[model samples]
Target: MIMDNWISIKIAAQGPFDLKRTFESGHSSFPIPLKDKQDRWYLVMRPTSINTVIITRVAQQGSNLVAEISCPQRELKENEVQSMKKILRTTFGLQLNLAAFIEEFKKDPIAPAFELYRGIRLTRAHNLFQSLICSILTQRNSIWRWNAQARTMAKLLGEKYPVGHFLIYSFPEAKTIVNHSELLTKASLGYREEYVLETAKTLANKEKKLEKLKKVPTNEAQNALLELKGVGTKVADMFLLYGLGKMDAPPVDIWIQRAVSHLFFKKKEQTLAVCRDKLNEHYGKWAGLAQLYIYCWARDHLK
Candidate 1:
């Protein structure tokens, strides 16, 4: 019943744990937070070396360990190791083909557009419920205010773990937040509190297939999300890109509309569908990554 030869060693990734956080974030599989002796946040790591799950943890001193969930059925052979290497490399941006692509773009540079926020990485690792809540909290609000709202919600509903000189907030489960509607006003979620509750209550029980979601048809996934109480195209795409790893998922926020509006179409009033088509044409398979990088860039610079 345990995993195969793949051991999920999450800590080995790096300090800016983008891929690890995405996998552990429940938007994919109910990413529950874990901790080590030093109270640092850890996630479940599934490595291919050994066929078992590891509740990977990082201590204050930065030591990493993989606590075996169960023993593997068999050791991963060399062929399997190579296969896993390929899968991991592709699935996660492990070895960013920075050399090849950076050379191509070197002539033009990353454009003045993407430079202001070169190093800002998204690090929020929460279950889809929390992701949905934060995304909903984000819509139509300033990113700063939305971040404030997120922090307020975390402080109000989530648990705080002290790690070295810093502290990280663990987002509460869907059931916890849904059961306490009054916390919204306290958390300053504003008008989206109802949306947050509705979405959470809807998925809190239904078994959602989120991990390895790239296999699912985009239309089906988008429709499924649309069926959720507060979820719409934007929310669905956010889940697809951030949680489910669909590189084709183009998440459209108002800021992005402005960024591409004049540049792509020579008009500032471009429609969402038009923008989607343009992005699909330009980014192709990795359109989701494009949207993410551009979204992060646009949000910071446009503001």
Candidate 2:
């Protein structure tokens, strides 16, 4: 009977929450193993120290959102439910205010591009560790390949639970990866195995440093992340933007490079340096969100 009870927590959508728009923004396009059926989207998190898999079903009900939180291994405790609520809020951008950014979008030079995909916000990982692992997996690989690698790693390293006929794996923690370093090989990480291992070890050893890094300025955070393995400029920017919630960081991938060149520079001859400076100047604090909208719009329109 305890398992039968689905703890429904209501999230205020007065900030104009758009579930579909959030996923469509391309932020959720990563291979994070988000399972959806009909209107209910399933998300799994391992928030507890004992590797408990918390399964949450989020759905839009009218203007607000309801999250049904559960745990297959055990009944969801109050603190566990509260932690799920916090993680869900972070993942869904529930606490973020987009009104100011939306207003600024009106005067943006790429206003049409941003308007085409409005209500889009950055969908972050459950934590900075997850974001760093995802960034390492994504480097120099096709979207398909990186997604596959991520799913494989999760299946091998993460805790999973059965829901009806389906089994979903939660995102693995740094300790999980640290213990099963051999599993990274099983996940087909190839040359990225060392980077993944080193990253996990670094996180495991440097909790205090990571905490200090989080409170620093964006430029300092970027520099700190760059010191990690397999973290180049783009990966550092990705970690800052999506992981640390620095909206000013515009991650310049190849597609974004081409998109910014065409839109702001008027041609493909613009360098990445020029493109980043010009766009940051134009959008200011909204640079990262603007990048997401412009990238999504350009992929749809420019192609």
Candidate 3:
């Protein structure tokens, strides 16, 4: 916990926890507007599960990015903290090492300059119901379609927050969505609706017991997440990686499958076993970090 003059902290070139992306993925809260806000990503950190909820603008200052941390639980110790600085120096870039990783990217600096972020975070689900539902929407569809389903569902269930023109909303909970489950199904979820309801119901039944999942090992956590319908390996990995905060967890969606094929496997005929081995060998437990960087890069660069 570091405390310093707010202005000086803001301009410190780099800091950890300034990660522009949301720890949780389902929410529209982390606004990565296409063109308007180019220099920084507007994001809300630690929104639901954690008390560290704050809307902050994330931008790189010098070598490390900086953020205006706003969690109520944080007591910025009078002792100026350097923990933030350390995280950035270690996590940024794709080659995996901080400064070393940056040098690897220097070979093609343009892409790394704007999109990639560093650091490994252990996040509480942020919003379990939201992620569970979004995972359902994501099943068997392209990311584009998945986002559309989630957006529509959010508008249906979320309570709009008025922040000028930025109309963001919090994702609805299982208890709340239960009342409107019919509308959820009717909106093209079709067969997947059962899985969505089953997931929500399971969470609803468990209540706070789901917190115990965090203590369970990653394998157990992933297995439990999959027991509920609609939760396959990728969705389970989503909960483990984003919700339970497992680092090495990587959800091998079709996009990742294709990307791995192009970069590592070099053949459409490669076996899934080879893909898993290569991914595991390269990234180990931090596979999610590697996945995200490649996923982000592939989204923009891949043919």
- Per-candidate alpha-carbon RMSD to the true structure: 7.7, 3.1, 6.9
Best candidate according to TM-score:
2
lDDT of each: 0.53, 0.72, 0.52
Number of the top candidate by lDDT? 2
lDDT of 2 by residue, 95-197 (tens): 6666666765677666775457656666766645766777777778766677788888878988766664576766677877888887788888888889989
Local accuracy of candidate 1 as per-residue lDDT tens digits, 224-255: 77887667787777777665556677778786
Model 2 shows how many backbone clashes? 0
Which digits, one per residue and each the tens of the lDDT, describe model 3 over residues 187-229? 5676777887777777764545556776888788878877887
Ranking by TM-score: 2, 3, 1
Where model 1 places Cα greater than 4 Å from the true spot, the runs are 1-110, 113-116, 119-126, 165-167, 212-214, 296-303
**Candidate 2 wrongly placed segments (more than 4 Å):** 1-3, 14-16, 28-32, 47-53, 72-83, 205-211
TM-scores for every candidate against the unseen true structure? 0.64, 0.85, 0.65
In candidate 3, how many Å is residue 194 off?
A: 2.4
State the weakest 10-residue window (summed lDDT) of model 1.
Answer: 62-71
